[model samples]
Target: MATEREIFSNSGPLDLTAVDWTNSQHRRTVAASLVQGTYSMEHDRQQKLQGHLALGPPWWEFFNFQPVQVLVDEHDLSIFGAIFKFKFPPSYGNYLPQNPPQYVVAFRGTITKTDTKKQDLKLDFQFIRNRLHQSTRVHLAMQAVQNMVSIAGAANIWLAGHSLGSAIALVAGKNMVKMGCFIETYLFNPPFTSVPIERVKNEKLKHGIRFTTSVIKAGVAIALNSQHQRSQKDHSFNILSGWIPYLFVNPSDPICSEYIGYFEHREKMMEVGIGNIARLATQNSLGNLILGATGKDSEPPHLIPSAYLTINVSPTQDLKQAHGIQQWWKQNINCQFKLHQYR
Candidate 1:
């Protein structure tokens, strides 16, 4: 964790003109287009874009990947380039029952590409820190929220994203709640490469905000350790747990059980519930055998029943084929053990 003073002193002024903004824009355009095209193909639909790039049909359709439409039309006031909103259907079963239709919005304008040439010249530290970029993303998200509220009416909102998007979502959600809006956020695999880990630690000390974030343990060890620093702080905005729930469904490796146990120890530090889906897999493979909790003190307090109405696919069965532990939980764990699979 770098101090604000250290970041400012060590990171010198940036020469924006020295870096080819035009080339950067071209690279960004290409990247964004590829993402848009890939998603459009998966959805089996085309969205009109103000840009000139035209994408082909879904390439991953054979993989059974569902296309989620995240509006990216810069020409429309209803949508914008910086903000992307995608609605996941109830059929997805990730949402809680009785909750309003949930939408996840990604604030995408915060990433700043460094001027490598200036670094070679020893003159790349005067302009702005990467956190400033995150701050800009926060501003853009606030504007988007104001616009969304006008058109969509009041609804439950969830924030999610990877990398820079994840960091922006965390900061934006915090600001949104300060404005009296109820927002819950989920961060997926954010890295601590650019921002100072200590700033994130300090921000989590604020009160009166409701934000829940999940990060892959391996993906954010440094950030996780920073969050752990303020574990005992009694603030509404602070992260209740040092580490979020650990998903343990990697059957290929023999030491996976040990890894799960390691994360479970950290989870216990925060007093958050530990979701054990491992036993459920065994029960599903063994012909409807009821697996009881290993002990009376188990967090969930019961074995995940085989008769649990899993949406369309067996949640436990899906875990067996999961490539990563995170995917297993996202696909198998419903709001409260109710598994729903997309068709």
Candidate 2:
């Protein structure tokens, strides 16, 4: 185990493009980097559970199963993973708004049942929680970042994951905050749609907890909430709209479009007459299962057609029915918007 300074000196000038992140050298480099800051590693160790910090065969096995390559520099860290995007139209016109190109970090990982065939529901619950508890993906990520900082300097970091990777990224972001590291996270179609309000609040309280951004195009949020509503708080579980923005992009279908509109206006509509009546009526009839429930089982409201116009790329014939909205409202409402064709 080398100190951070030693590793930095030995590695020479850091070239993110040169490092084969999918190889074992990358892991070793990251591990060494993390151990460099005496205080940082100590802090991470203290915050992590006993078994949670172990970076042994079991931990390495997970990443080996699915390898994702990442590129990091002083300005940003970008991931190249199993995730890729293809647009409908061929070109993303120059007129579209664009955000600063942030570094993308990609991870290839899997989450699986540690145990199966347990008939006792209680036992199953414990098993599942324990499996989730022992995951070391984020810990490894933190280490890699430490290495990056050692070679380069402090940089804005963003984590992106598709499915299971998204959930892992969320967990990793929370763990990083506990370790006193701040990084922004972006998740696309994450498998778990909602998080416990208490957890959400605690994460929000962390000094470095910038935001947990999410993008889910369809009814995934509703379906996930419907299933896990019992464990979440309504108001506490609002979309990660604070510094982190959750964008919901919907294509034009009347019902889908209306649902989007309802999401965009539900909060304000709740303040008026007929809209309030309609909201309450829908809530009662559906067991308060629609988007705006404020209890454990409530769903975050969706952003519809009008909301889409506000956030989406300038409309084209191809975007006839699309709309979008952010989940939280605490951040400055400035996002560079762009349209890309994925076909």
Instruction: Report the C-alpha lDDT of model 1 over 18-129, residue by residue, as the tens digit.
Output: 2221342222222222223333321232234322222322211111123244433222222212333333345547743344223435432221223112221121121122
Q: Lowest lDDT 10-mer window, candidate 1?
A: 296-305
* Error of model 1, residue 284, in angstroms: 42
Best by lDDT: 2
Per-residue lDDT for 126-244 in model 2, tens only? 22332332434445555655554344333444454433344445555544544555454443323322222222235335212211111121133444455344234322222222223
Candidate of highest TM-score: 1
lDDT of 1 at 127: 11
RMSD per candidate (Å) reads 19.9, 18.6
* Residue 78 lDDT (model 2): 16
lDDT of 1: 0.29
TM-score of each: 0.33, 0.30
